[model samples]
Target: MPNLNFEFTEEFALKMDQNDPLRSYRDQFYFPKVNGRDALYFCGNSLGLQPKSVKTYLEKELENWANLAVDGHFEGEDAWMYVRQKSKPALAQILGAHPHEVVAMNNLTSNLHFLLVSFYQPKGERTKILCEAGAFPSDQYALESQVKFHGLDPEETIVELAPRAGEHILRTEDILAKVKEIGSSLALVMMGGIQYYSGQLFDMKDITAAAHGVGAYCGFDLAHAAGNAPLKLHNWGVDFATWCSYKYLNSGPGNISGIFVHERFADDQSLPRFAGWWGHDEGQRFLMEKGFIPMHGADGWQLANSNILALAAHQASLDLFAQAGMEQLRAKSEKLTGYLEFLIDEISGNSGILEIITPRTASERGCQLSLLIHKGGKAVFDSWYAHGVVGDWRNPNVIRLAPTPMYNSFLDVYRFGKILEQSLHDFA
Candidate 1:
């Protein structure tokens, strides 16, 4: 790779921004203004800024509700029952999944629980669950609860894989080894697609194959991975996956989440699920029959009526995603994020004030870079916020900066580097 330090200059950064094919995408979002200027936001890994068109989408629903009342479900311009269907192709394009394999439904954790109810079949000797050691809290909680619900002891039935001592990232070889050793007794193998803290993109293809070879079901929590990286859930043979849209998806906070069930399990009517009216077959839905008949694909997994307003907001974001193809977005992301890494490495040299815990390789990580502040810790990070550079601090000493390809630019990375330099100098 070319030297990142020499490649970024004021003139060069400005020129790159000018020639950027995706530069117009910035206009779609609404960023917070600070001190009469738009703040430099690098927290897309946590909460993405809302799209400008979202308000219009919400207003349309409000108007329908006012004019039609209960009749709006069937008579509105965008019928509520069919609203999710509109977003399927767009979301499917982003995830590299077929439209029939994906569904828009409940929030991330709820979907995870629903999926586990059907996929995590722990019987006899194959009753242990395997996951990364420091998974997102919600995932950890879901696993523990699932084990408890099955009347099993979590301490005995849950196995967590940790990185080697003195290392922050887990090696693929180590993970495979552990899976092989515990193969026969493992009931489920699930992990975050990209680790939230370290930003390491786990090898899903390898892991899924191993899990299947051992007769275990494999799933993924794509909370931080979905739109931030390229994914082919179907081709990878993952049993199931779920993701929130607020992060790299650029949907607003608490926006609708999505779930994917490979075609292999689509018609497995034998699988047990916590069913609801929404999951019932749409053709016979009005029949109010005693027995439930699920839709042939992912739509069959829905449990209740969806929140159409949130789905509308999600559509606005997905429209933008579709316009900017994921492959193109990912290409720009590699260069933009690589530029960020270059800037930080230059400024932090010999100061020993910070260290990047996220992996260095472009292929091994996503957009977020976790900075381990070595000097003033949280105090130093808070000062950066006071200076109008917005990023997230995750306990102890880490500040995460996610330079999203859709909105963030090379200049933003350069400005953040200057701010970080000043903060470190002041602390010394």
Candidate 2:
């Protein structure tokens, strides 16, 4: 984590930007406009800005489809049949797993369901799954339905862990304690890699160990953590994980998601899964075999052939990630997000109008800092929007600002601070 000795002046922000190693990346994305000016985008947690190269990537695939038609699946430089392989190298780097352990596939929830089919095994006296309270709605629905599918009552089969009273983030010790308390009956330990609402990054390594010690499978919903935070699924011994590509990933909205299954389970043929032709061994795939012979590693979980155009757009951003590197991006992200938190503290001061609910430490969060509105509510958010600030507003009260290191700069954070100052005063 960078030193919090941050300055609130524009000159300070400018100097920091001038010294940033990833500063050139800001020009690579197209920002949305507010009124006549480019908006200060701090919504990467919700949806990332589009990379300018997305069009070029899409065009190449379209041309291949036009000229090759049926042959496009086999003859093109990036054949649709093998397109999933193109993303593995970069996704592996971002996810800290071996290339074979990760695969780009269905949307977030679908992949979760598929992984649940294999991981969420409930035997006698071991029938409960644990997760954070207020998890993203999709995860809640998936878990609820999965429990019902097994003819179990969700109220009894699922455990939701909330923060302590008056707390907005779950503490590491508290989470571990809960895992231990749920020990004997815990079928699986599943939670978001980062809490979406509180911007809290959980200690996956320790949590995974605790789950394993208690004889349970561990998994994560990485939709908010994949590109924004550093992860080591392989080393942590995470049994399974999945994430969407549209947020910090900078892929198009609702694009394909990625899956990670530990190599230990790679060739375990006896493990149960919903099989499809795409996941069959290549040698026998064309035979139209009556039996399902699964491929090794995460590839065995794929349910269908790759989506060429979507993978094309996904590749464009993954290429940039490969060039920029996760370590370098994470370094800048720490400082950039730290500066935003510093400025928010300075502006909010002792005025009880707003409070930052996100964790204060860099290790406990990614790039997002969710602000809890105590006074102006949506009116204050509207004021920021009117002043050319693009942030995410949650249903009742919170405003989320994610200063993505790939494209956002110190100047953007500084500008948003000024806007926030004005908006608070006007609403107050």
Candidate 3:
């Protein structure tokens, strides 16, 4: 049916699968089945499939806790007292950051707020916070409250850049131009590293340069980009960032987030921050003194004792990342996502009913592809889901599917193509 040089067939899919280098990694995860067949899972952008090793990894911690009781904090293969440190080296490799620059901590928004208290200090006329319009609700709320906390009205203090009329995504030049225009007035530029709904990857390095040129701080919410893209946070000079682990990292629901603060501020404890005892110097932490002496680097940002159970689960995933490595993962991600694009185009050839809103170039996106279904809209998505195709639907007729390289296969993309064609035929 595809007017192409290549045929879309199950045998063709099998050939591609046989050649894939990461194909074995698929067995490392537990797939959810529908109607007794492995579901065509393209939902890694929302929630990644569980790693098979996660159970055994979690069980080790459970054993430690049950046997050691309070002593578990200091004794065991993974001692709870310094449990969070286990993920830092792997996180540093994944994020292109120094181990000292990254910290495993609270949820994404919470870390954003904690970093904001130090970085989003607005003085006099440089009191505005700039972010993408329609940013994730939690980010918008955090920015709004941070503005109001400074006795500034959100309506006036928060600045937003919306895509032009009829445009589905923002351009890099447009974003950089706006940053140059905001100039001195913009106190901070915080946006998602990758726009969630449209699957647009922002030019973080260039944007950071532009913000710095204007004397404004730069930060990113990398919830969708962290494990999905190669993020050189340290080399890019990004001031700060936060991301959750549940999505692309294959960690379980509400797993703890990671943060990156540039090494320049690693020892600047003089900066104003909301302090906690866990952030105090570990050597004298038990002294229980009145004065708070913060620890060095991102460890200083910790507010509470490690969520031991969650850290154990998170380490289970980061371990795999360290083994597979981001470079190899990203190489396959581009090909897998490109194949998804090719299949979508084959299905939507002459008819313009389905629109791919994500950028076409591999460099401009991660693994997710967002489709705008013109007719039947949400109904089309429902039909797809009913047929064992697992993807997420955004509001106003958008279907976002991500065939993650870690656990997804070439055959999965091909089978999804078949399912999508059937869904369309039924809806049409």
On lDDT, the leading prediction is: 2
Candidate 2 lDDT by residue in tens digits, 1-428: 55557998999999999999999999999999999899999999889889999999999999998999999888978888888999999999999999999999989999999999999989999999999999999999999999999999999889999999999999889989988998999999999999999899999999999999999999999999999999999999999999999999999999999999999999998789999989999778888969988898999999898888899999999999999999999999999999998898888798788899999889999999999999988988898999999999997999999999999999999999998888767867
Question: All models: lDDT?
Answer: 0.89, 0.93, 0.89
Q: Model 1 over residues 134-189: C-alpha lDDT tens digits? A: 89999999999999999999999999999999989999999888888898999999
Estimate, for each residue in 306-384, the C-alpha lDDT of model 3 and write its tens digit: 8887888888889989989999999888888888888888887866579999988788899999999888878888888
Q: Each model's TM-score, in the order given?
A: 0.98, 0.99, 0.97
- Per candidate, the number of residue pairs that clash is 0, 0, 0
Worst 10 residues of 1 by lDDT: 1-10
Pick the winner on TM-score between candidates 2 and 3. 2
Best model per TM-score: 2
Q: List residue ranges in candidate 3 displaced over 4 A.
A: 1-7
On the 0 to 100 scale, the lDDT of residue 162 in model 1 is: 92
**Candidate achieving higher TM-score, 1 or 2:** 2
Return the TM-score for candidate 3, rounded to 2 decimals: 0.97
Error of 3 at 56 (Å): 0.9
Worst lDDT run of 10 residues, candidate 2, spans: 1-10
Checking candidate 3 for backbone clashes, the offending pairs are none
Model 2 bad stretches (over 4 Å): 1-4
